[model samples]
Target: MKIAFVGKGGSGKTTLSSLFIRHLAAHEAPVVAVDADINQHLGAALGLDEAEAAALPAMGAQLPLIKEYLRGSNPRITSADTMIKTTPPGEGSQLLRIREDNPVYEACARTVRLDGGDIRLMATGPFTENDLGVACYHSKVGAVELCLNHLVDGPDEYVVVDMTAGSDSFASGMFTRFDMTFLVAEPTRKGVSVYRQYKEYARDFGVTLKVVGNKVLGQDDVDFLREEVGDDLLVTVGQSPWVRAMEKGRPARFDELEAENHLSLQTLRNAAEESYGNRDWERYTRQMVHFHLKNAESWGNAKTGADLAAQVDPAFVLGERSAVPQPS
Candidate 1:
């Protein structure tokens, strides 16, 4: 299962992301946590040792190798072998060597961290390259997806991608890749507005989403969000001073935490487990294609009309289902 987190900046994506790795690791589920945000923080939140962080290069480093292998560089360097080799260095290397067909494999190499449990956690640094364009995002994300596709062989493995805030290319792109996307927002008008915009964009891409309201403080804040979004509140991460301290790299007592504490993280993770099922990307793409292909004309009319609804409703003169048909 591939799970992704998206929210406005400072909306606690990294905190929840770290918690996800910890939760999965505790339960012995192999996880690859990718930090897709430009400014990375998942490492620090997870209490990663400097040495461990330094060893794992961004998955982007393998793009050139991927191109080479695709052009028939070597039969032994399959997608699976390449991902296994490129993972955050640790004992997974031993398993590589045991699979004799892998020519590049070496025994006992530090490639991935296996905490003597069923789970192994690997994290990718954030994407900060600024020459923004669809091609650049696609290239980087393509590599990340390639790596994930290689590591996660079946439904047993899970990937947690911590995405940057706002309705930007990276955030939108993250939605396209994951089976399900979680949109996070704070208890402010700005946060709600941002998620709403993100929701609109996600709809354009036909993304299946669930919203999370983080940093919920009082009844008023909760009521406002409930009114704006609706009663299907996925999870509300309570506002906690300790959470802020954690962001600043300080440790605090759990008792000091408030309602906007990690409780939402627990709720979010639970929803993820419940919502997760066997996913087929091909099926998702087909459904999306149908949506756009079916609504192509109405969307175009909406663009030209004064009111967007005028392009869809039968009551509107310019609508696709209107009484009179207009010229092209």
Candidate 2:
């Protein structure tokens, strides 16, 4: 199952992401967490010190190598240099499984030990001085999008992503990649505004978006979120001294979580468990091909000086384990 945590700035999406990751890891679920946020704070929330977090290789810095590895021996993909971020997986392209022994994970992710067990994490990377005038954050996030596009996971496996705040993810098809997206909304109007934007944007795509109300102080706060979002409000995390202490670098445990907070995490876990059986490979494959063609037409062909549409093998299906002959 794949999960995305998103929200308005300071809505504690990163904190909630870490909590969910911790809960999954502690329960012995195989999972990987990706810090796709430009703010880049998921590591600190996961208990990594500044130096250790900085040491983990940035996925953006390694785009070329990742593209090279993921292209594999696909006949349609003649060269890695021709591979754009939206390149969809075909018959011969390499596909990723969660925590599989692979060079991509070795180079881009690091293991962080926690009270339960260690969890693997990867980051899209920080906006550097070089990118100040020259780049868009989308370029950095493309690594994650491509990874998700090519990844094939079993129901027991999990991928948790901490998305960039607000609707910034709408700039690309990244928001549509998750199996379920938890929008961490506070009781404030500013919080629900993001939810409204996301719900409206994703309504047409059939993305499963549920709300996790954070910082709820009382029934009034909970009522405010319910009144605003209705049944979409899956669960709420109330004020938590334990979370504050942990985020402050003091030790904390999942068992020590406030009753409501712990129940909220369980609700999320239950949702994930239920969704594994509902995997939609056809929709996933459609999305990959859709974005690939869109990018190819938009700028990929001009940038690569070749008809990038050749990268898609019409006879090849993403989830089916079979091969098709290369077209003449």
**Most lDDT-accurate candidate:** 2
Where model 1 places Cα greater than 4 Å from the true spot, the runs are 49-55, 67-139, 148-153, 170-174, 204-206, 241-245, 248-263, 278-281, 285-328
- lDDT tens digits by residue: candidate 2, 232-325: 9999888789888987889566778777777789899888777666767787778778878888899999999989988888876666353222
Q: How accurate locally, in lDDT, is each candidate? A: 0.52, 0.87
- TM-score per candidate, in order? 0.63, 0.96
Give the per-residue lDDT of model 1 (tens digit) for 1-328: 6788888888777787766566566557766567666666766666556666556456555555543332232222333323321122111111111112221111111234323233333333444545454334444554554343323233556677887667763321335556657877788888888778767776765555777777777788888888888854676667556656866767454434454444555676667666556455444434323332333344422443322222121211111122121121
Query: Per-residue lDDT for 77 in model 1?
Result: 32
Query: Which number leads on TM-score?
Result: 2
Give per-candidate clash totals. 11, 0
User: Candidate 2 regions off by >4 Å?
Assistant: 320-328
